[model samples]
Target: MDLKIFSTLPILLLLYLLDCGSAQSPPPRGCESSLESVYFNLCDLNAVWGVVLEAIAAVGIVITLILIVVLLCIIPFIQDKRKKASVAIQWIFLNSTLGIFGLTFAFIIKFDQRTCPTRLFLWGVLFSISFSCLLAHAWRLQRLVRTGEGPSTCKMIGLVLVLTLVQVIIAVEYLVLTTVRLNNVCSYENKDFVMLLIYVMFLMALTFILSTFTFCGHYRKWKKHGAHIFVTMFFSIAIWVVWIVMFVRGNAELNKSPDWDDPTLSIALVANGWVFILFYILPELRHITCPAKKEDDPPENIASSQRNPGLKGVDNQVFFLEESNRGIALNFEDNLHSPSYRGPSPMGRNVYSSPQEFTIPRPHTRPSYHPTPLLQDPYLNYHNRQTTF
Candidate 1:
C-alpha cells in the first residue's frame, strides 16, 4: 500500500520462493506426515497467517529500531555529566544489543532459521543490561547515602561491563549445549528447559537483591526527607514490576493459546504507557530537589526583591522614647489630673492655650522628680535634714 511496504515486496517474494524451493528439496529421515507433532515446521503456516505475522513482527522491529535511534541521538545532548554518561552507555547497550540485534533476530530473521538458543541468548543479554542498569541505580543510592554525592560513570561502566561478561558466559554455555543436543536447526520446545530455569532463577535472584537494596534506599529517604522520594521511587519500581509481570503472564498465555489475542499484550501495552509516565511524567510531577542556580536568576530580579520599601512593626524602645517626649504636652490637658490629686486643678480645667505653651521652658534633659518620705516619724532624721536644706 505504502512505499515502504512496496519496497519490501520483492524481498518477501524472494523469501517465499526460497521457502518453496527448500520445501520441495527437503525430505529428511522419517520426517513426513507421521511425525508432524514431533517436529514443528513452517509447513503448517497458512498464507494469510504468515503474512500477518511478518507484518506485525516487522512493525515491532521498526519501532524498536526507532526507539534505539532516538535514545542514541538524545543521550549525547544531556547536560548533566553523570546522567549523560549513564544515558549514553545505557543507550549503546539498548540500541546495539537489545534493540537492534535482538529485534532483528527475533522478528525479522526467518522463522525456520531462528533457533531457541539464539532467542534465549538475546533475552539473557537484554535482561542482563536492564538488570545491570538497575544494580548501578542501587549502587548509586548506596553511595548517596554513605556520601552525599551522586552516581559516577565509573560505577555505571563497571556494573555494565560485569553484567555483559556474565551474560556472555551464560549465553555461550547455552549455545554450546544446544548445538550439541539439537545437531540441526533448534526448535523452541526441544531446548533444555533446565538451563533456562537456572538462568531465570539467577536473574530473579539478582532482581530481588537489587530491588531489596533499592527499597531500603527508598525507606531511608522516606525517614530522612519525608514521603516525597518514597512516592517517586514507588512509581518508578511499580512501573517496572508491572512490565515484568505482564511479560511473564503474556509469555505463559502465548504458550497456552499461541494466539495474539492473549491479554498479555494489553497488559504489556499498559505497562509501556506507565513506564513512559514514570520516566518522563513523574519527574515533572515531583518538585525539584535542587534549588535554582544563580545563573538562572536575573540581577534586576534580585535588586527588586531587596528593595521592599514598607513599614514593619515599631520597636518597643523607640516607641517608649517617642511616647515619653510627647507626654509633657498632654500632662495638664482638660481631662487630665495628677495621680496624687484626682480633683481637677485650675490649670487642668483650661482646654484653651495653656500658660505653659505661651512660655514653654527649655525642656529638662532629665526629670527632677524625687520620692518623698512616707510619714513624719520622731526617730527619723527628716526634720534636721529639711531645716538644713
Candidate 2:
C-alpha cells in the first residue's frame, strides 16, 4: 500500500502541472478586427497616435527648413553688432533644428537595426551643440556687459564645437558598445538607452546655470538678452522635467499594454523642438531681422520734443523762415529802441551781429535795406513822447 501511494504521488504532480499550464495559456496572436484594437497596437502604422506623430514631425521639418532658408537669405543684411555676434549661434540653431528633424524621424520610423544608432547618437550630439551654443551666447553677453568686451566669433564657435565634440565622442562610444554587445544588430531595450540621455541632461544643466549667471547683476546693458535667455532656459528645464518623468516613471507604470514608449519620446522631441524654436530661435531671428534703433537722437531729446509740441513747431518754423530769408539783408540799428524790443527778446538780442552775416551774398533779385541809425532817426524826437504814454 505504501509503494502504491508513492507511485500515485508522481501522477498527481503531473496532473497539477498540466492544470496550471492550461489555466495560464497565452492569448491569441495577430490583428484584431475592432477599431479600438487597431488603435492600441503600436506596431501597426495605422495606429492613430502614430499618424499624429508623423504629421507633427512633418510640420516641424517644414518649419525648420523655412527658418533655415530665411536665416541664410538674411546673413548678408544683418549689420547690428549684437546680431553679427550671434552668427555662430544661428548656424548651430540650424544644425540643432536639423538634429531635431532627425530625432523625429527616429520616432516616426519603426525602431529597428537601421534607426537605433541614428536615434541614440544624434540625440545627445545635436542637443549638446544647441545648448552649448546658447551657453556661449550667454557668456558673450555677460562679458560684454560686465567687462565691456565680448569674445571673438572664432572663439565662440570653437567653444561650441569643443563642447559638442565631447558629446559626440560619448554618443559614439555608447553606440559602438551597444551595437557590439548586441552582435551588430541595433536592438536595444528602452531602459538601456536611458543611460545615454544623462549626457544630454548634463548639457541642459550647464546651459541653465549659464543662463542663471547672466541675471546675477543689474545688467542694464544686457537686460533684454538676459531676460530672453532666462525665459528660454526656464522653459527648457520644465520641458525636460516633464518628459523625463513621463519616460522613466510614467512609462513604467503604463507599460502593461502595447508600449507607449515611442510615442512618449516622439512627443518629447516634437514639444521640446517647438519650445526651442519659439523661445530661443524665434527671438534671436526677430532681433536680427528687426531694424536697429537710431542712437543719434537721445531719448531725452525725443521725449522733450514730444512733450512741447507747440514750442517744437514754432522753433522749426523760425529755423525755416530764417533759412528762406537768407538773401535779405536789413540794418537793425534803427530797431534797437523800437517798442517791439522791450528789454531783450528771447530769440537773441544780438541776432543780427552774428559772423554768419559776412558769408551771406546779397541775392541779385532782392534789394538790401539800410535803415538810418536811431540817433539820426526822425522817430527819435517822438520816442520820449511815445514812451511817456
Query: Judged by TM-score, which candidate is best?
Result: 2
- Cα lDDT over the full model 1: 0.45
Total clashing pairs in model 2: 0
lDDT of each structure? 0.45, 0.68
Candidate 2, residue 200: Cα displacement in angstroms equals: 1.7
TM-scores of the models, in the order given: 0.43, 0.62
Cα lDDT tens digits, model 2, 1-389, are 99999999999999999999886554334334343332333335446666676677778888888888888888888876666777767777776976786587676666666777788888788778878888888888776555445788989899988988898888888777766786764666666677777877887787777776666543344656766777877887788788777777787887632267777778878887887778877787777766556643433465566678689778876675565444232334445545564432233323334533423332222244332221122223333443554
After TM-score superposition, the amount by which residue 160's alpha carbon in candidate 1 deviates from its true location, in angstroms, is: 1.7
lDDT of 1 by residue, 1-389 (tens): 69999999999999999999876664344335444332322223432333344344445555556655666666445553434444544454444332423233242223344444455566556546655554555565454443334567776778677866787787777677767887653544412433453543465456445444444432243122213233434453555455455455545555743343222333332333234334432342232223334553333454344464332233544564455445544543422343433442344334325534443122333364332223122223423443454
Candidate 2 wrongly placed segments (more than 4 Å) = 1-46, 184-187, 216-221, 256-258, 291-389
lDDT for residue 268 in candidate 1, whole number 0-100: 32
